[model samples]
Target chain A: MVSAGAGQAVDEGADSDPVIRVRGLENRFGSDIVHHRLDLDVRRGEILGVVGGSGTGKSVLMRSILGLLRPTGGRIEVFGQHLRDADDVREIMSHRAGVLFQDGALFSSLTVLENVELPLKTHRQDISTQLRRDLARSKIQLSGLPDSSSAKMPSDLSGGMRKRVALARALILEPELLFLDEPTAGLDPIGAAEFDGLLHALHRALGFTVFLITHDLDTLYAICDRVAVIAERKILAAATLRDIEDLDHEWIREYFHGPRARAVRDQTSPPG
Target chain B: MSDPAQMTEGRKDDNEADLVWERGTEGLLLATGDWVLDNVELLSDRVDALAGLASGLDASGISRLDASGALLLERLFHRTGQGPTAAGLRQQWRTLFEAVDFACDDTHEPAPASEAPWRQILERMGRSTVEVVHSTHELLGFLGITVHRLLRTVVQPRRLRLTSTVYHMERTGLDAVPLLILLSSLVGAVVAFLGATVLRNFGAELFVIDLVTFAFVREFGALLTAILLAGRTASAFCAQIGMMKLREEIDAIRTLGLDEIEVLVLPRLIALLITLPLLAFVATISGLFGGLIVSVVSLDINLVMFLDRVEQTVTLKHYLVGMIKAPMFAAVIALIGCLEGLRVSGTAQSLGEHTTLAVVRSLTMVIVLNALAAVYFMELGW
Candidate 1:
């Protein structure tokens, strides 16, 4: 029941107020403007998949909302409070959110368990060391890593395993919101699918809001409750896969109707 | 109140995370408050007190719970010798608890035991000795490869990369000229000052010219230039090639049927060989000029007399003695840098370590070779 040209506007029509809100967002480096007056909302407890062509400022947008990059001009609200570019507000936001950067970004020196335990130690110093280790171990187990991998350094692990370690570290604090930047960009197809499945399971079980940036159509189809298409310096459309697939837009039409997209669609959808 | 975010914030109050129970009859253990990451210290403290309680956990009184909290609850269950039941928990809390419980294997792997200190020291010393021997062998092998490649290029002139050689020559030679001149001139002036001071006591101040010219020509010029290159160019070569190897660029050249030695090492080596001797010559001239200025200004030695003195005493044999060591020093420095770079193994740390080793080894070899050359020249009575 995919209606043609159904998702034309960039507005979100969810009943509940969103967990993250961006309004009049503008990002500029020198004379080159990456984003201008970009407005979007990330609803509570939904995997909002963000898709864009390379250098379309998908990462810049994520950074701005997460307070890593201060937008040139914009209002960003997380958990119903305006972000003021202050350290305290950023600290509070950091506690509530976990980010999985592309390439994992695990500290090369620290072991997998130490890397995961670090956040708990930093945020909650009053928690005993034993409890911290146990929590880190649980997070590692939830990340689908064998307990043996816990003592190994990040440099010794494969790229996939490193990503899992990063995920475990991200989930250790049990954040209310999660941000993933190109989480499946470099994995093999099977590995990417398995990661997607793991993410889906965790999302369901934890019930936390997810803001995922990805170019993988399979990942978008597999886990995203809604897809937000960023193009032309703003969010072109933000809607479910079926709704966005029928949008009368150039990038969206090309992206969702491409040969690869067709294959992903066939694999994800049932027979007509 | 309907907002989960607001509810979570509200549950952050310290009093919300409390555990209450009757010691007898009911076995009803009530867990209250926010059981999240922020309240973990308090929750864990409360949980530790009831560590081995074999009571039916009625977590219905719990206001909030997250993964960290659920993991803490699972720890309590493990201690109590019972699996957590969903009987008295909310549906969402039950799911979270199950997710954590399914993954939480609380049995820790004991730390590996340490060896005796003496045994450890012995093992380390043996390992280092083996490493030194292995490194020397590898260095000899790399030298053989480089020599073979150089001979091949000598036979087939077209195989030499002229552009790369010139580029490196400009970098390692031309760019280094000003610093070399500055340091050599300063050293020459200092030597003249000291010599003049000592000779004036004997009323033989004219001998300062001989001292300055002889020191610069036979020893200081070549030694100083080589030492400077050891610091500057050798480290540069090591870091450049180490980064290339780290990024697999060296491997890419090999896959393309190109010899990395020919493509990467030969140019740097040839450039240093050509430029080092030239730099030594420049350093010699600058050093003499420094001596000339000091002698004229301080020692009252006329320019003509100073030149005449240098011409009379310092023979062509001394210049040859100094110039001969430049190419030798250049080869050692270039080879050590390239060999250390080629040995880098897949980490930024390794690159840093190899770069440092390149500089230290090249500096040591330069000084050692210079000392041997000095002894030989003295024995031959040059």
Candidate 2:
């Protein structure tokens, strides 16, 4: 079943156009289906958090939107360009969006600075080597990584620093949209909060849309403008935190009303 | 959206948030605009240059600040010891500045750029030597553990994975037959041709039969087959086990209370032991058949005469000696492959490196063992 009214409700609230629109999306691997008639929208310049239980296809949805995976059936549009006919999705998406993979996915052979410089070198082939290095260095610094980390290999850095390097690489091209897959999955609470704060600050300063796939409740509360809960092979709800919390879905109630969720909410709330 | 570079260029202009310097009695410097992450880079060079000249820092003119911008200001203040000037900031800005100051207190200093080339080479040499010793020690330890596990499985026959052993036999042995036969046949013909040419010059052309029979039965048959298997099956084992390790499947097996050596290594080891000798026998037969064809066609030796010569020169002892080396070669290859696979670390690069290492190591060990067997059989007057 498809929910057109719910999708339209999202469209009406945003002043700007939706950066990503998925309608009747279906993903299947042989006989096993991951998504069915999934309808969702991510508005421009907003941090939209996608949350779901394990194997619920949150990642599949993200991959479909990024054009990494071809959906079995759907009309998926990014920046109003239909992805179905694109011969090279990677090349097209590389100009408009950057993704931070869960494991950082930094090239093991390259230093952190070189990893950050890769996108710039790939896209801006005509730029001088010196200017490329300068831009990459600024991005690394903006990610809150120290100057010393520039020459170190990804394997040599801590998990948190590696994630920062990945973030730096993702931001190097200055894309209009950024995709992050479990950005804070491995970091400790303090480190995750700091990463969340960095993402929030970067979003405000750069005004780019973020499609963040995460299981971290604190991230949704701290940085997300809206939250989309995926269950039963489709989007169960897509709205702000308060609205998602009030939804009647069983999984949604369990997720938002769980003890851990309440604890994070209490901890993040301002004192009276 | 049309051109990403143009979008970045437009954003760059907006992010060049200006820095204002006021000539005052106190030589105070004022910064304005959103001195945040995006705009902070524009001020770094100016801040560093002015840090030495300015008397003190003033953030009163700053409209906004974040961690990135505050870190720069913190560095400027640290360089000039102008901490007292931070009091002029709003509460939020002051808090952020203080936080950055505390967070970056132990900031890592970049390593010095210059090092002597000779010293660097020496350091690398020393490191490599240590790594070689460490890896050798690990390899020996792995061998000992594998042997012990194998013995344990021998004592408890139920632990041996019979189905896995059969599967590996089909992969490493059965699948290798055609290539082994083809290679041995070609080599056998070449050897016969060379021997016939050389022996004919000395009026000993008939002795070509001895050369073909002795070489194939004693060394060429087992050596070629083993070398082929080392390159083919050993590398496959390394890659398979290495990928399993990378994916943590080996760890999963361990967590399930299974002995890794018994489950992973023993099947491959037993399969190779059983199949290598059989493959070597087939190669010996195929090689002799090739020599038979050459003798019949080139030398005009009849089938009866060829069989009589082979029967007389190629004894059971020579065949036994060659077949004996087959199991040893198989053991070396399988052990090396499994060892290298288990030694694989995190990356795909590491898995590739280990796979190559397995083939090289197995081939070297097989050749060395074959040489040692040759010397032993010669000394014993076989």
Model 1 CA lDDT for position A3: 18
Most accurate candidate by TM-score: 1
Q: By DockQ thresholds, what CAPRI class is model 1?
A: medium
TM-score of 2: 0.77
Q: Give the CAPRI rating of model 2.
A: incorrect
iRMSD for each candidate structure, in the order shown: 1.5, 6.9
lDDT of each: 0.86, 0.82
- How well does each candidate superpose onto the true structure, as a TM-score? 0.90, 0.77
Which consecutive 10 residues in model 1 chain B have the weakest lDDT in total? B1-10
> Across residues A56-160, which tens digit of lDDT does each residue of candidate 2 receive?
999999888877788999888788877875465766688778899998999999999899999878877765565466556667877888777888888888889
lDDT of 1 by residue, A202-221 (tens): 99888899999999999999
Q: Which stretches of candidate 1 lie over 4 Å from their true place?
A: A1-12, B1-15, B26-28, B53-56, B106-128, B194-207, B345-350, B379-382
Q: Chain A TM-score for each candidate, in the given order?
A: 0.95, 0.94
For residue A234, give model 1's deviation from the true position in Å. Answer: 0.4
